[model samples]
Target chain A: MPDPILAARELTKSYGRGPDRFDALKGVSLDIQHGESVAIVGKSGSGKSTLMHLLALLDTPGTGTITVDGTEARSLSGRKLNGLRNEMFGFVFQQFFLNPAASVLENVVLPLKIAGVGARERRRRGMEVLEQLQLADKARNKASNLSGGQKQRVVIARALVNKPQVLFADEPTGNLDTATGRIVEDILFDLNQNHGITLIVVTHDHDLAERFQRRLYIRDGLLITTDEEHAA
Target chain B: MKPLEILKTAIANSFRSKLRTTLTVLAIFVGAFTLTITNGLGTGISNYIDSQLAAVGPGNAFTVTKTDASGGAASGPKKYDPSIKRVAAGGRPGSSQLALAQSDLDKIGAIPGITGVAPVIRISPDYIQWSGHDKYQLSVSALAGAQPQLASGTNLDDSSTQTQLLLPVGYIAPLGFADNNQAIGQDVTIGITDATGSMRTVAARVAGVEQDSLLSSSGIAVNKALSTALSQAQATGAPSTAVSAWTDATASFAPSSSAQVSDMKSKLSAAGYTAQTLDDRIGTVKTVINGIIGVLDAFAVIALLAAGFGIVNTLLMSVQERTREIGLMKAMGMGSGSVFALFSTEAAFIGLLGSVIGSAAAIGLGTAVSGALARGPLSDLAGLHILAFAPGPVSAVVLLVMVIAFIAGTLPAWRAARQNPIDSLRYE
Candidate 1:
C-alpha cells in the first residue's frame, strides 16, 4: 500500500568502451519496499553486484534512473548523495574490508566518525553495537586477530552502527564455512524481521535466496524472474 | 570528517611506513640544520657590529675630507694643482691627501645641521715610555667623540684640563704595568719631533686601558687636552700658514634620523668635500660578511629543495600503498577535500618534526662552539659571539620549511583525492 522505498527504472551500466565494452547491467527494473528482505540471485557475471551497486547509489547507471525515497539519484548533488549514503545506507562485503591495524572498535566507529560524532559518543555507540553483536569483550582487539565468523559479526555491527534504513550485503558469507555462513544469514534475517530494517542481499547461493521473502533471479544482465514467498 | 579527526588519522597514517618517513625527515633535517646555523652566524656578526657601532659612539659625527678637483683615490693620476696642499694621509701609508684649510673647516661648520667641526690635528708622537721603561713607538690620535671598550677604569675626560690618554691593551704588559687596573692612573711620556726637528716630551695620565677591537686595533685614543698639548708642541717654530691646514676634519651634526644624516652628507658632497659616517667607513666589511652569509643560505635552501623532492617521493609511495584504505574512506563519505587535507597534514607534520629537531640541535651546538671560541682563539676580541639564534629567525626557518613541505605534498594529495572510489575498491 505504501510507496516502495527504492525504485529503479530500466537501469543499465557498462564497463570500458568500443569493442571491449561489456554491459554489466541491462534494462533491469526493480522496487524494494521498506523493511523487506530481498535477494538478488545470479551466477558469476550475471550483473547482480552491479544492480546492487546502482540501487545503493555507489555507482551511476549508464541509462534510466534510480530513485531513493522518491528522489532521483542523478538529481542529488554530490554532497547530498554522499550524505545520504553516510546516514541512510550501510554496506557489507564478502571480503570484510577492515583496517587490520586498527582495533575492532575503531573499524566499527568509522561511519560515526565520518559523520563527525564526538569521541565519547562514538565510543559509546560503537560499544553498544558491539555489545548487540556479542562482541563487546573483543572491542579493543585488533581486527586481524579475529576469527572469520567473529570478523563477519564485527562487520555487521559496523553496518548497524549508524542505524541505517537500508543494509546492503554483497555475498556476506562467501568467505565463511557453512556453520559460520548460517550464523551470518540468521543475523541478517533477524535485523530485517525484528528491527524492521530493509535488507538487500546479492548472492549466487540458492539456499541463501530461499530464506528471503522475495527473490529476483538475474541472468545475462537482465532480471529473468521475480518470486515471492510467504513467511514460514 | 572533522579537521581534527582528519589530522589525527593523517598522523597515524604517516608513521605506517616508518623507515620511508624517517629518511624523508632526515633529509629535511639536513636542510633545516644548515639553514639555522648560517642564519645564526649572520645574526651573530651583525649583532656584534651593531654593538660595536654603539660602543664607537659615532652616532652624530662623520669624517670630512677635501675632494680633489681633478680626480680621487680610485681614479687615475691627474694634473697637479699649485694651490692644493698635499700632506701625509691617515690610515694609508706612503700616500698623500689634499689638505683642508681653515676656510674649508669654516664652510663645513656653516652647514645648517652641522653642530660642530674639529680639525684632526696631526700629532706625530715619536715614542712613548712609562716611568723608566724602554721607549716604544706609538700611534696617538684624537678620537673626537668615539668611545672604545675599556678593559679597566674610565674613558679619557675630554673636558678635564689634565692631559689624558687610554693605553692600548697590547702595551699594558710591555709598558711595565702588572695589569690593566695597574696601568690606569699612571702618567706616560710621549716624545714628539717639533718643526725644528728637536724631540720634546709631553706627559699624559693613562685614564684607562683599551680592549682590542676589530676597528682601532693599534691606536691609543687621546683626549682634547692631550691632543691640543701635543699639537701645540709639534707646531713650534712652524709657519703660521702651515699650522692652519689639516688633512681632514671630524664634522658633528644633530641627526634626528638616518635620512637627515644622508641629507647632510649630500650637502657636504655638493660643497666639494666627501663625508663618511662611521657606518659608511665600515660598510664594505659588513657587505662582504653579508655576501658570504647569503651564499651559505643559498646552499641551505638548495638542500631543503632536495629534501622537498624526498617528501614528494615518500608521499607518492604512501598514496600508492593506501589505495584500498583511501577507497574505504571515500565510500564512507569522506570528501575529496578531506582526503587531500589528510595527506597534506601528514607532510606538514613531518616538516614540523624535522625542523624543530634541527633548529633545537643547531642552537645547542652553536652555543657550545661560541663559548669555546670566546675562551680560546677569539679571546682577544671580547664581546664577539660567532653564532647567535634569535627567536624570530628560528621560528621563520621552521615556518619556511613547513611551507616547502606543504607545497611538495600537493601533487600526491591531489592524486589521492582524484581517485574513483569504485575503481580503487575494485583494485586487486
Candidate 2:
C-alpha cells in the first residue's frame, strides 16, 4: 500500500562513448518497499552491480529516474546531495573500503564524523553499533589488523552508523574465504532481522538470491526476470 | 571536520612516512635559518652603526673650506661655489685638510643650536715613545679643542701636564687588539719642530686612555718605539718639529664661553681660514664604518634568499606524499576551503618551528662571527666588541623569517588541497 523505499525506472548507465560505449545498466526498472529484503543475481557483466550503485546513489544514472524515500534523486546537489547520501543510504562494497590506518571505531564513526555529528553522540553510537556487530572487543584495533569478516563488519558498522533507511550491499563478502563469507552473510541477515532495515543485495550466488523475499535476475545490462513483472 | 581535526590528520599522515617528512622539515629549516641569520646580521650591523653615530651626535655636520669643487686647493673663495660642498677627508684641495685654529673652534661653538666644535691642528713627523724604551715617529693628528668635558677618568685640567697633549681616543687600532685594557696613564714623549727648524722633545704622562680603543697590530711595534722616544722628549720638555710655531692670530683670545668660541671660529673662517667641527670629524668616521657594515648585511640577506628554494622543495614533497590522505579527507565531505586551511596551518607550524631553530643558530653564529671580525679589524682600532645574541635585531629577524617561511609554504599546500579527490584517491 505504501510507496517503496527505493525505485529505479528505465535506469541506464554507459561507460566511454561512440564505439566504446558499453552499457552497464539498460532500461532496468525495479522497486523495493520499506523493510524489504531483496536480491539481484546475475553472472559477470550483468547490470546487477550498476543497478546497486544507482540504488545506493553512489553513481548517477545516465538515463533514468530514481527516487529514495519519496525524494527525487536527480534534484539534489552539493550539501543537499551529500546529506542525502549520508542520511538515506548505507553501503557495503566488495573490497571492504575501510580506512586502514584508522581504528575500528574511527572507521565505524567516519560517516557520522563527515556529517558533523557531535563527538559524544558519534562515539556512543559507534560503540553501540560495534557492540551490535559483536566487534566491541576489536573497536580499538586498526582496521588493517582486523580479520576479513571483522573488517567487513566494520564497513557495515560504518554504513549503518547514521542509521540510514536503505542498506546496499554490492558483493559484500566477495573478497572473503567461504567460511568468512558465510559469517558476513549471517551478520548482514542479522542486521536485517534485528533492525528491520531494508536490504538490497547484489550477488551471483543462487542461494543468496533465493534467501531474499524478492529477486531480480539481470543479464548483459538487461532485466531478464523478476518475481513481479511490469504489465507492459 | 574542524580545522584542528584536519591538521591532526595531516600531521599523522606526514608522520607515517617519517623520512619524507623529516627531509621536508629539514629543507624548510635550512631556508628559514639562512633568512634569519642573514637579515639579523644586516639589521644588527645597521643598528650598530646608527647607535655608534648617535653617540657622537648628528652625522650631517661638515666643514666648508677654500678649495675648488674639483678638490684642488682653491687659492681663495671664488664665484659660483656650491655653498654646501663636502670636505673630503685628508689633504684633498677643497677638503677640510686645512687646519682649524682656536679662533675657528670658538666661532663655531658660538652658533646658537650648533652643538660643539674642536680645533683640529695637524702636525707630523713628531716622535713618540713609551717610557723611553720604544721609539717611533708619530703624526700629531690634532690638538682637538675641548668641548663640555665628558665624564672621563682622565684629568683634563692639568695644563702644565701637556696643553699640546694628544687625544688618546683617536689612535686607530689596526686589527687584532682584543686584550689589554690598562694602556692609560703611562708616560710618553713627543718631539715637535720649532720655527728655527730645530726639533725639541717634551716629556708627558698619559692623561687618559679612550673608551674607544684601537689595535693596529702592524703598528704595535712602531707604537712601542714611539712611546720610548716620546718619553725622552716629554722628560726634556723640548719641541720636536722645525715649523712648530702656532699659526692663528686669534689663537691668543681664550673664549670665556662656548658662544664666544663659535663667534671666534666664524670670524676666522670669514677671514679665509678653514675650520672643522667636532661633529664633522666624528660623522665622517661613523659614515665610513657603517657603510661597510651595511654592504656586508645586504650580502648575507642575498645568500638567505637563495636558500629559500630549499623550503619550496620540501613542501612540494610533502604534498606529493599526502595525496591519498588528502583525497580521503575530501571524500569525507571537507570542502576545498577546509582542505586549503588545513595545509596552510601545517605550513605555518613548520615555518614557526624552522624560524625558532634558525634564530637560535643565528644568535650563536652571530656572536662568534662578530667577535672574530671585531678582533681582527676593529678591536684595536675602535675598541668595539660586539656580542652574538643581540636581542633587538635577532628577535625581529626571527619573526620576519618565520613569516616568510609561512608564506613560502602556502603554494605547496594550496596545490595539495586543490587535488581532485577521485584522482588523488588513486595515487600511489
Candidate 3:
C-alpha cells in the first residue's frame, strides 16, 4: 500500500469565541491512502462536515495539522493554498454552483481559464471531460437551461477538467431523486475504479456509507472507525 | 489569464448585459460628443478669423486719422475702452475712426526696419463725373494715388513729372468709346465745378483703367496727370476746389518680418495712433470663439460626471450579482490582480465603445452643422469654419474621453476585486 495521501492529527474546528464558541470538530485524527474510496458518514451537526471542510482546505483547522499529498495544508496561504486546492482536488457540492449566464461548456472550462490554461488546450480538455460525462450534446446550452442531472454532470465535468488527484464530494446525491442518485453514484465509482483517483465523500445516508471500503462514523464531534467497531 | 483572453471574456460578458452596457455607453457618447462639436465650432470660428487676417495680408498695417466719420475732431489721447458703450441720440452715431493718417504713415516708415506705407482714404459726398455728366450733383470719390505704390499696375516712377492718367476699374466711358479697353489710353473729358461755382470741362488721356479701386468708379482717376490738370486749372482760374475736396489720401506698407510688424504696431499705438494689425484681429476672433468652446467643454464635463456615476452604479451592481462568480474564480487560482484587471478591462471596453460612438457622432454633427452654417449667416466666416475641424485635436479629445471613462470605472472594479472569496462563495 502507498503512503497516506492525506493525514490529519488531532484536528479541531470552532466557530466564534468564548461563551458563544461552538466546537465543530473536537481533536479528530484520520488517514486516507492513495486510490482509496472513503466515506465519512454522520448525522447532521456531528462534525463530519467540519472534518471534510478541513480535509479539502476549505476551512482551516483550529488545532493540529493536515498534510495533503506531503505538504502541510495548515500552513499554506494565498497563492500556495489556491494552487494546492486547484491542482490537488476536484470538489462536488450538494448544490451545484454553476454560473447560470455561461453555457455548459463555458461553465466547465471556467476553472481551466482561471488557471490561465491556453484556449485551445483548455477547450480540448474541457470537451474531453464533458464527452466522458456524456454531456457533449448539452455543451452549448446555458446552465439555466440544463436539467438537474445535466447541471450536476456539467459541474462534475468542471471539477474534473483540471485532473486533480482527489475527488471530494460533499453529499453528491443529496439533492437528486433515487434513480438520478444511482446514476451519480455509478459515475463516482467509475471515476474511482477506472482512473484510480482517491475519493473522499461526506454523506449522511446510512445505506450509502455501508458500500464504501472504509467508513468512519462521526457522532457528537467524535469519529469511530467502522472496522474497529467490527473488531470490537 | 492572458490579458487578451481576459479582454475577450470581459467583452463577451458585457455584451451579455446589453441594456446596462448600452446605457453606460450612451452616457459616455453624449459627454464626448458634446465636447467635440462645441470645440469644433469654436475652432472653426477662430480659424475663419485667422483666414480673413491672412487674406488681408500679414505685413500690411492700418492707420486712421483722429476724427469721427462726420469730420468732427476725434477725442485725443483716448484708447478704445471695450467696457464703454457709445450711443447715438437718433441717427447713426459717428464711430471713432480706426484708420491712421499719412503723417502717421511717414512716422511709422521712419521707425527702424520700416518699409512702405499706403494711406487708406475715404471721401465725403463721394462722387465724380466726366464732361457729358453733370458736376457735384453726382457724389463720386477720387482715391489719392501715392507715388511708386501702384495697387496692381506699374509703380509711379515720378509722382511730380508724369500727368499720366490712371482709370478706375469698371469705368464705362460716355457713349462714343468703341471697345472696353478703348478708353485705356484715350482722352476723356471731365466736368468739375470751380471755387466760383462755375462748371469747367477738362480733357485728359486715360493712362490705365484700374480693375480695382479703393473708392467708387464713378469718380475720375486721380493719377498724377489729373492732379496736375486740377492744380494747373486752379492756377489758370478759380477752378473747382470742390473737386479737390472729393480726394482723400491713404498709404499701405509691408514690413520685413513679423517682429517688425509688432514693433510698428506698438510704436503706432504709443504715438496716439489707433491702428490694427492682422494678428491682433485674429487674436480677438480667437478670444471670442474660445469663450464659446469653453462653455461647451464645461457642459461636456457635466455630462461626463453623470456618466461616471452611472458606471459606478452599474459596476457596483455587477459586483453584487457576481459575488459567487468572483469567489469561484478566485478559488480556481486567479490572483487578486486578475480580478481587478478583469473588472477594469470590462469597464474600459464600455469606454472604448462610447468613445467610438462619440467621435463618429461628433464628426457627423460637425459635417451637417458646418454644411448648414455655410449656407446661413456664417457664410462670411465659412472658409475659417471649415478649417476648424482639425483631426488631430478631435482624435486627442476622443482618446482623452476614453481615458476618463476608464478612470471612472476604477473604484467599482477595485471593490469587486477585494471581495473575500470564502464569503462570496457562501453567498446565495
Candidate 4:
C-alpha cells in the first residue's frame, strides 16, 4: 500500500513531573492509511484520547516523531503547523463545541472565516456542507435550539467545511442516544468510505470499535494489540 | 482573519454583555462631554478676543514709554528730579510718570522701522453739552488710530480738518439724542479750563456712535483735529515746552512679521524706551483665561483616565467569561495576535461610541446655551459666543478617547491571547 497518511514511531507523552508524573502514552506506535477507518479503543485514562491528540498535532509527544504526508511534524514551524491543521485536518468532539449563540450556518463557516474566505464564498460552502448533512433547513436557527443529533451533525458539517484529508472524531456520538449515536456514526463512516477521507475514531465502546475496518485496543498507556497485528 | 472581519466580530462581541459595556461607555461619555465643552469655551472666548482686537485696529502700533536710564524701573521710590516733568499716564489712572518730550518723539521717529510717533495727547474736558441740554461730565481722548466698533454712522474722520468725535453709546440718551442714529453728525460743545483757570468751549461734530467694549469704554473718541483743538485751548497761556511733554507715545512701525517687530522693539529698548504691542497689553487676560480653562481640562482628562480603569474592569470580566470561547477560537487555528486584536478593537469601538455620542451632545447643548446667553445676560457684548466648536478640536477629542480605551484594553487582551487552548477547553 502507499505510505501511511499519518505515521507515528515510539511516541510517548506524560502529565506533570517527578513523583506526581503519570505517563499518558508509553512508547505507543501506530500508522493510519489514507481512506482507512480506524478505531482507537480504550477505557477512560487508557491513553486512547492522548494518542489521537498526538496524531492530530493538537499536542506534542514527549519523545519520538510523527510524520504527516512524508513530512516530519517537528520540522514544521508553528505557523505552518497551524496552517496544516487548518487546511488538512478536521475534528468532531463529544461535547459538540457548537457556539450556541451563533446560527447553525455561522458555526459551520467558522473555519472558513478563520481561513480568510470571503463572505459570499464562506456562506456558499457553509450551506453546501449543511445541505450534505441534511441540515440545510435549520441553517439560520440558533445552535442551542437544535436537538443533540442535529447538533452533532452541525459539528460534522463544520469539520467537513475545509475539505480536510483527515477527519478525527473523539467520542463524537458519546452524548447522543443509541439510535442518534448510530445515525452520527453512519454519517462519519460514510465520509470515510465514499469521500475517501481518512477517519480515526477514539472510543471506549467495544460495539463501536467492531464496526471500523481496523481496531487498536489500548490499556494502561500501552496498545495491547491490533486486529491486523493479530491477523498477521 | 481579514481586518474587516475581525473588526465586525469585535464590534458584535462588544455588545455581548450589554449592561456592563454600557456602564463603561457612560463613564467615558462624561469625560468626553466635559472635555469638548471646556475646549469649546476656550475657543469661543479666544475667538471673540481676536475679533475685538481687530476692531481696536492696533495690530500695526504699540505703546512706548521711557524706562529709567539705569535699565530697569527702580523697585523703591526715588527723590523727584526737577528737570523731568511728570504727567498722569493715560488709560491708567492715578499713576504719574516722567513725561516724554518732543525731543523723544523726534528720536523715536528716527528709528529705522518706526513709521510715526505721536504722544498720547491727554485732554481733560470739564463737561459736554448738546443742543441746549444740561451739561454732562466728559472723558475725552484722542482716537490714536483706533477704529472703535461703530454702532451707527462711520468712524471719526481722521483726515477731516473740522473737529470730529465718536459719541459713546452711553452718552446718547444723556445728551438728549433719540438714538445712536440721531446723535450722528450733530455738534457738541466741550468745555475745558485752560492754564489761566478760565473756562472755554469748543464745538465738535459727532461722527459716529461707539459700542461699549470691554476696553476703551466710557470715553469719547476724538480725531486728531479735535484732539489738537482741545489741547491748544487747554494749554492757553502755558509754556510751549510744557505742552509738548507727554507721559507716553503711540509709535507705529512697518507692519512686518512678529520677529521683525520684536527686533524693532529691542532697538527701542537699547534707546531707553519700553515698547509693548497690543498683544502684550492683553496677554495677561489671555493667560488667566487659558489657565482657568487648562484646570478645567485637567479635570476632564482625570475623569477620562478614571473611565479608562472602568474599561479595564469591563474587558477583564469579558475575557474571564469568554475563556472557553477563546480556547475554541484558538483551537480553530486563530493566532494569538488575532485574539489580541479582537479584544483591543472591541475596546476601541466602545470608546468610539461613547466619544461620538458625548461630543455630539456637547455641540448641541453648547450651541443652545451660547444662544440663550447672547440674547439674555450677555446681550451687550455683541458677536461674543460663549461656546464655539471647531472641527479639528472635536475630532481630536474623539481620537484621544479611542487611544485611551485601546491602552486600557492591552493587559486584558494579552491575558486572553496567552491562554493555553488545552487548559482553557478543560476549564469547567
Candidate 5:
C-alpha cells in the first residue's frame, strides 16, 4: 500500500496549567493515508477539535510527533510551518470567518493571495473553484450578503483555491440548517472521492461519522478506536 | 502578500467602521490644516522679506560707519568722547556720531579689494515746492549710489550734472504735482539753509516717483548733484577736522558673496570701523518676526501630536474588533510579518486620508485668505501675500503624518501579529 500521508504519535496538548489545567489532547495517535475520508467524532470537550488543530499544524502538541509526507511538522515553527500548512492543508470552521467587507471573490482568493500568487492566476484559480462550488454568480457580492450555505461554500472555495492536499473541516455545517448541512456534507465527500484529496472532518454526528472510510472516536483527549493501526 | 494586495486590504479594512475612522481622520485634519497654514504664513512673509532685502543694497555693498555710531536699538546712553565728532545720521540714533570725512573715505578706498565708495549724505532741506504751491517741509534722503526702485520715471544718473529727484506718492499732491505720473519730469526747488544760516534754494528736475515702501514712506530721493549742492551749501559750520564731514560711507568690494562680505567686515572691524550689511541693518527685525512665526508653528505641531494619539486610540480599538478576522488570516498561512504589515498599512492609510484632505483644504482656504488680505487689509503693503504654499513642504506634511501613524500603529499591530490563532479564533 502507499505510505500513510500523515501520522501522529502520542500527541499531548494541555490548556492552562496548575490545578485548573485541562488536557485537551492526551497521548492520541492516528495515521491517515492519501485520498482518505476520515471522521474524528466525539461529544463536546472530547478533544476532537484540539486533535485536528494539532494535526493541522495550527497548534503545537505539548509532547508528540506529527509528520506530513515524511517531514516532521509538529516540531516546525514560524514561516516554514505556516507555508507548509498554507500549501498542504485547507480549513473550514463552523463560523465561516469570512471578511464580510470583502467581495466574495476576494474572500475566496485570500489564501492564494497570501501565497503570493499573481493576480491573473489568482483570478483564474479563484473563478475555477467558485464555479465548481456553484458560487460563480455571487463572486461580486459582498461576503456579508451571502446566505449561510453560500458563505460556507465561499469558505470552501477559499480553502480549495490553493489546491492543498488535505481539507480539514471542523463542524463545517454546525451553523447550517439540515438541508444546507447535507449539501455541505455531500460537497466534502465529493471533494475527497472525486478530486482524490484527503478529507478530515470533525463532527459529533454519528451518521456523518458512518460516511467516512475510517473513524477515530476520541473521548477526554484519548483516541478510543481507529479502523487501522499503523506506526508509520 | 504583495505590497499592493496588503495595501488594498488595509484600505478596505480602515473603512469597516466608517464613522469611527472618519472621526480619527478628522482629528488629523485639524493638525494638518493648522500646520499647512502656519507653514504657508512663514513662507509668504520670508519671501516678502527677501524681495525687500534685495532693494536695500547689493551683495557687495555695505554701509561703513564710525565705531560709535548707534543704529536701530541701543542700550544705555551713548558716552561722551572728545575725538568722535557727532554728525546727525538720517535714520540712525544719537547726535554725537563720528562723521566719515574725506580722509576716512581715502582710508576705506585704500583697502585692497575696495572697488568703489560712495558717501551717503543726509541733507535736511528747509522746504520743497513745485509750480508755486505752498512750501511744505519735506523728508529727503540721497540714494543715488545704490540701485533705485522706480515706479514711474527713470533712476538718477550719477554723472549727469542736472539735479534730478524722486518723490514719494504721499508728496505728489502736496508738492503741487497732478499725480504720480504727472510728477515725473516736473522741476522742483528745494530750499536748504546754508552753513552761514542763509536760505539757499536749488532747482532739480523730478526724474521718478518712488513706490512707497515701509522704509521709504514719505521721503524724496535726492540725486548726486542735488546732494552735493546741498552738502557744500551747509559745509562751512561743520568742523574742519580731517575726517569730520560725511556721516557714513558705502563701501563696495569685488567679491559679492556673503562669505567674502564677512571677511571684509572682519577686516573693517579690526580697523575700528563698523560695517552693516543691508541684511545686518534689517536682520534683527527679521529674527523677531520669524520667532513669532516659529511660535505659531509650534502650536500647530502640538495639534498634530494630539492627533497622533487619536490615531493610536482608533487603531488599538480596530485591532480589538478585528480579533477574529486577524486570526482567520493567520490561519490561512499569512506569516506574522504579513499580519503586522496589514495593520501598519491600515494606520498609514488613515493618516494619508487625514493629511491629504487637510492639506487640500488648507491650500484651498489659505490661498483665498492670502488673496483677500492682499486686496483688503494689506493693500498698502505692496507685493505681500499673507500665505504661500510649496509642493515639497506640502507633500512632506502628508509623509510626516503617515510616519507618525506608522509609529503609533506598531504597538497595536504587534499585538495583532503575536496573537495565537487558536486563542483568537476562540475569541467571542
Candidate 6:
C-alpha cells in the first residue's frame, strides 16, 4: 500500500508530425510502487518502451506528465532532472550498450564514473559488484571479448553500480540463449527480491510477464488490460 | 562530472581513434613548429640589431662635415678651391684631409640646437707595443665614448687622463697577451714621431679589447689624454697640414631623440654643414633584416592558421562518432555544460600535445642550426644567433595553439551538448 515510486498520468508520445505523425503512447497511465516488480507488455509499436522512457525521464510526454516520489518531474531544470535520473534509475538494454574499447570493470564503473565518484573507490565498488555477479575473473577483459550471457551480466552490473532506487530493463534477455536467458531472468528477480528495489520491465515475453505481480498490457498505444483482472 | 574527471575522460577518449588523432596532432605540430622557429629567428636578429645600435654611437649625435659650403655641385672632381681646402665647392671622397677652421667651428657651434661640436682629431702612431710585443704602425681616431664591440675587457674611459687605451682583439697576440683579460690593466707603449722627426714614446694601460667588424676593421683606441699626446706628438706638431676642413665632426644635439636628430641634421644642412647620422646608415640595414624576419613569421602564422582547420575536422569527427557515448553520459547525470567541457578539454589536450612536441623540437633543432651558422655563413656578423628560443614567445606559441584549438572545438562541442539524450541513445 506504499505510494508509487514512479507514476505516469495520461502520458502521450508521438513520432514525427503533421501527416506523418504516429502516436506511440496515447493517454497511457500507470503506477509502479516502491519495492514492487511490474511488467509493461505490448507488441511492437505498442508504446511499452515509450512509456518506460517517459517514466525514466529520458524523454518528456507530449500531452501529459510524470511524477517520481511525489515531485512533478516535468517542472525540474535539465541539470536537476539529470541528477534525479542518476540518483533514482538504472537501465539495462537488450543490445548491451557497453563501450567495446573499455574493460569489463570500466564498463561496470561507468555510471559511478559519470556520477563523479573517485577512481580508486569507483574501481573498488565496481569490482565488488562484478564479484557479486561472478564476473570478477573477467574484470580486465575488454567488453568486445565477452560472450552474449557475460555481456548481459556485465550490463546488469553497470545498471546496478549506482545503487539506484528503481531498475528498468527493456528486453534484458532478448539476445541470450534459452538457458542463459533463464539465468539472467533469475538474476533480475533475485536483485528485486534481495535488494527490495522497484523493478519496471518492458517486454513482449508472456513468460516474463507471468512472473510479475502487476502487469499493464498495452494494445494500440493504450493500456487496456490488467493481467490480474483478466485472471480473476 | 568535475572538471578534473572530465579532463581525465577527455584524455582517455581522445585515444579511441588513434590514427585519426595522431594525424590531426601532427598537422598541428607542423604549424606550432613553424611558429616557434620563426619567433626565435626574429628574437635572435633583433637582439643583434639592438646590441649593434648601442655600440654605433650616442643616439642624438651625428658626424658633421663642412662639405660644399658654397651649396653647389662641382660638375666634376673640381681642383682644390683653397677656400674649402683640397676640393672646390663640393667635397670629394678623398678630400678628408681638409680641416675645419676655428672660425668654421665657431660658426657650427653657434648653429641652432647645436649643443657642442668636437672635431674628430686623427692620430697616427708608428707602432703599439705591450710587454715588449710590438704591432705595426696604425692610425687611431679619437671619438669620445665610441666603444667598439667588446670581445673582452671593459670599455675605454673617455675622461681618463693618466693614459688608457682599448686594444683591438687582433692586437692580442701581437701585443704579447694571451687574451683580452691578460691585456687589461697591462702597460703598453706607443711609438710616435714628435714634431722634430725623432721617435718619441707614450705609455698607456690597456683598458679593454675591441672586436673587429666588417663595418670597421681592427684598430687601437685611446682615451682623451693619450689621444691628445699622440696628436701633439705629430711630426709637424700642428693640428693639420691642409688646415684640414675635417669632413667628420661629432655634433651634439639638444633633446637627444631620433626625431630631434633629424631636425638637427636639416638645420645643420641649412647652415652649410652636412650632418651624417649613423642611424641613417645602420637603420636601413636593421630594417632589411627585420623585414625578412617578418616575412618568415607570416609564413609560420599561415601554417598555424591552416592547422586550426585540422583541429576542427578532428573534433567534429570525434563528436559525430561518440554520439551514443555523449548521450549515455547525459543520461547518467552529466549536464550539457559538462559535455561541452569534455569536448573542449579534448581539443585543448590535443593542442597541448602538438605544441609541446613542436616547441621542444624547435628548441633542439634551432639551437643546432644557430651553432652551425655562428661558425659558418654568419661568421662575419659576429655574435649573431640565427635562431634563439625566448621563453616568453615559446610559451606564447603553446598558449596560442591551445586557444585556437579551443575555438575550433566550440562548434562541435556545442552540437554534442545540445543533443537530446533519447535521440542520441537511439543513434545507431
Off by over 4 Å in 3: A1-3, A10-12, A16-21, A59-64, A74-77, A219-232, B56-288, B384-390
Q: Candidates' interface RMSDs, in order?
A: 1.1, 3.4, 2.0, 1.4, 0.9, 1.1
Better of 3 and 6 by TM-score: 6
TM-score of chain A of each: 0.96, 0.93, 0.95, 0.96, 0.95, 0.96
Scored by TM against the true chain B, the candidates give: 0.80, 0.52, 0.54, 0.78, 0.76, 0.72
**In terms of lDDT, which candidate is stronger, 4 or 5?**
4
Expressed as tens digits, the lDDT of each residue in A7-108 for candidate 5 is 999999998989999999889888899999999988899899999998888888899899887889845668888898789899999898998888999999
Please give, for residues B1-428, the per-residue lDDT of candidate 1 as tens digits.
89999889888888878899899999999999999999999999998887666556566787899986765568878766776788777567887778999889999999889999999886789999989998999887454887778889898788999999988789998988999999888999999999999999999999998877776658788999999999999999999989988988999888659989989989999998999988887778889999999999999999999999999999999998888778877777777888899999999988988899989999999999998998999887887898999999999999999999999999999999999877777776
Give per-residue CA lDDT, model 4, range B238-324, as digits (tens): 988788898789999878999989998999999878989888887788899899989999999999999999999999999998887
Best candidate, DockQ: 5
**Clashes within 3 Å, all models in order:** 0, 61, 21, 0, 2, 7
lDDT of 5: 0.84
What are the per-residue Cα lDDT tens digits for candidate 3 across B394-415?
8777777767767877887898
Each prediction's DockQ?
0.54, 0.19, 0.35, 0.46, 0.65, 0.51
DockQ of candidate 1 compared with the true complex: 0.54
Model 4 clashes, total count: 0
Error of 5 at B285 (Å): 2.2
Worst 10 residues of 2 chain B by lDDT: B215-224
In model 4, the fraction of reference contacts reproduced equals 0.31
Cα lDDT for residue B341, candidate 5: 97
Residue B258 shift from truth in candidate 5, angstroms? 6.9
Residues B1-428 of candidate 5: C-alpha lDDT, one tens digit per residue: 88898998899889889999999999999988988898888888887776666544555677898786454565656667675566665565654567877777888887766888888766778898997899999767644454445678887776889988877777888877777889888888888886678888889899987766655446676767878887776664655562246778888777667777787888888776888877787788789879988899789888988988998899899999989888888888889999999999999999999999999999999999999999999989877888999898789888988898888888889999999988889899
Please report, as a residue range, the 10-residue window in candidate 1 chain B with the lowest summed lDDT.
B50-59
Q: Which stretches in model 2 have alpha-carbon errors above 4 Å?
A: A1-5, A117-122, A227-232, B58-210, B213-332, B340-428
The worst-scoring run of ten residues by lDDT in candidate 6 chain B lies at: B86-95
Q: What lDDT does the true structure give each of the candidates?
A: 0.89, 0.62, 0.69, 0.88, 0.84, 0.82
Between candidates 2 and 6, the one scoring higher on lDDT is 6
Tens digit per residue, CA lDDT, model 2, A41-108: 88778878778867776567899999877888898775676667667778776766676777999888
Off by over 4 Å in 1: A1-4, A194-196, A226-232, B41-135, B140-166, B184-208, B222-273, B369-387
**Backbone clash total, candidate 5:** 2
